[model samples]
Target: MKIATYNVNGVNGRLPVLLRWLAEAQPDVVCLQELKAPDDKFPEQAIREAGYQAIWHGQKSWNGVAILSRIGAIHETMRGLPDDPTDQQSRYIEAAVNGILIAALYLPNGNPKPGPKFDYKLRWFDRLIDHAETLATSGLPAILAGDFNVVPTERDVYKPERWMDDALFAPEARAAYFRLLEQGWTDALRTCHPTETIYTFWDYFRNAYGRNAGLRLDHILLSPALAERLKEAQVDAQVRGWEKTSDHAPVWVRLRN
Candidate 1:
């Protein structure tokens, strides 16, 4: 099976680009982030036409997440993070499709550090890690895929020094990301191409995409059972050149039978 993760930026705004990519790539499962639409506003018809069934969690104009599968319609698994009752962001959604559990997440983009937002980001990470521990004990094969919004290593971004002050590259963010991997979840892309410098996202500013300046914030992480099945991982860099496209491109990985 082939699974892909993409932060579409806005489902409505990038519908055309998404459709084209879907037709061309045809991943068996897709975890989409940042739909930027209300629950009622999701374009179900368009997604259905492409031969996939989806379950989405949406909020007005900010964060949203969804899972799409051609193998089977997603069976509700979980929704939202468990720790914070007051957390109102629609950033977490999980479903089961074809016996494989998938978690689609849009982690908080904690900008302007040394402030409330950054604090929230760290707190959110703690909750996610706790939830992940619970999932680990299930023994069912799973894949956690999404735009984590955190760069795990220096090699992940184009200019590490320039981004040291940024939320995505902050020490706390990197440590939290490392903690997730240390818990035995396999970073599929890195597992496939251990030494390669692969990237999944580019900033819209300063002609970043034009110069191959990007970050590998989007990822597909697998449980131990699923980890053994990872076949190949790839980033569709070409997609960034599409008309009115998102700053991020699709990141995908294939699995064995």
Candidate 2:
């Protein structure tokens, strides 16, 4: 099974690029982030025509998440993060497809740190870590995939020093990311190519893509049951060069069924 994750930036605006990638890559399951559309606005018909069924939690103009599966019906498990019913960002969604449980998440970016947004990002990470502990021990075939919004390590970004002041590479955020790893969820891509410089996102500024300046923000994490099945992990970086494409490229993992 080919399981993939991508942050489309805006589902409607980039529908063409998305459809093109879907036809070319044909992943069995896909976790999409940043729909930037309300539930009613989701282009379900177009997605259906592409041979996938989807369940999405969408907000009007900002954060949104969705899961797409061509392998089987999506038995939705969760729509948003637990522990805060009042917090209403469409950032997390989970479902069961093809016998495996998948959690699709769009973690807070927490930009311009030393402020409220950064605080929220930390709190959110704590919640994710708590819930992830349960899933870690459940022993279910599970995958946590999407844009985590963390640079993770010095090796993940093009220039570590230049990003030290940025929230994505902040020590606190990176520490929280490591805490998730401590729960036994294997970082599939890093595990597959430990020393390789793999990047999934490139900003629109300064000709970043052309200069090969990028960050590995999107990730696919596998639980113990499915970790052993991981065969290969890759980024369709060329997709980022497509006309009107997202800053993020599709990242996928091939698993033995």
Candidate 3:
């Protein structure tokens, strides 16, 4: 089975690009982030016509997540992260599809750091860490896939010096990511292609994509059981060059069924 994750940026605005990619890639399971639309505004009909069934949690103009499955029924398990009653952002959704538990998430960007937004980002990371620990021991094949909004390490970014102070590359953020990995989740892409300069997101400004100036922000982490089945992992970097495409390209993993 092929599982993929992409930050569509805006589902409706980029439906064409998305649909075209779906036809070309044909992943069995897909996790999408940054819908940037209200629940009623999601293009359910269009997506359905593309040969997939989906469940999405959408908010107005920002922060949404969804899971699409073409291989089997998607049984939704959760819509939002637990232990955050006051937090209303539509950043998380979980479902069971094709015998694997999938969690799709859109971690906060937290730009212009050293402020409230950055604080929220760290707090959210803490919450995710707490939950990931439980998932690690659930004994089910699972994947945590989405735009993590993190650079993770120097090798994960194009220019480490230029991003040292950025929220995505901050020491605290990177440390949190490492701590999460300690919970027994494998970073599929990195595990598959360690030492390679792989990237999934490129900024639109300064001809970043043309220059290969990018960051590996989107990720698919596999639990031990799922990691054992990992056969291949790659980034569809060319997708970032498509007209009116998102800053993020699609990243996928092929698992032995």
lDDT of 1 by residue, 126-163 (tens): 99999887777678898899999999998899988999
For candidate 3, lDDT tens digit of each residue in 54-153?
9999999999999999998999999888898999999999999988999999999888899999999999999998988888998889999999999998
Model 2: residue 241 alpha-carbon error in angstroms = 0.4
Candidate 3 residues lying further than 4 Å off, grouped into runs, are: none
In candidate 1, the residue pairs with backbone N, CA or C atoms under 3 Å apart (3 or more residues apart, or in different chains) clash, namely none
Error of 1 at 132 (Å): 0.7
> What lDDT is obtained when candidate 2 is compared to the true structure?
0.95
TM-scores of the candidates in the order shown = 0.98, 0.99, 0.99
**lDDT for every model?**
0.92, 0.95, 0.95
Model 2 misplaced regions, further than 4 Å: none
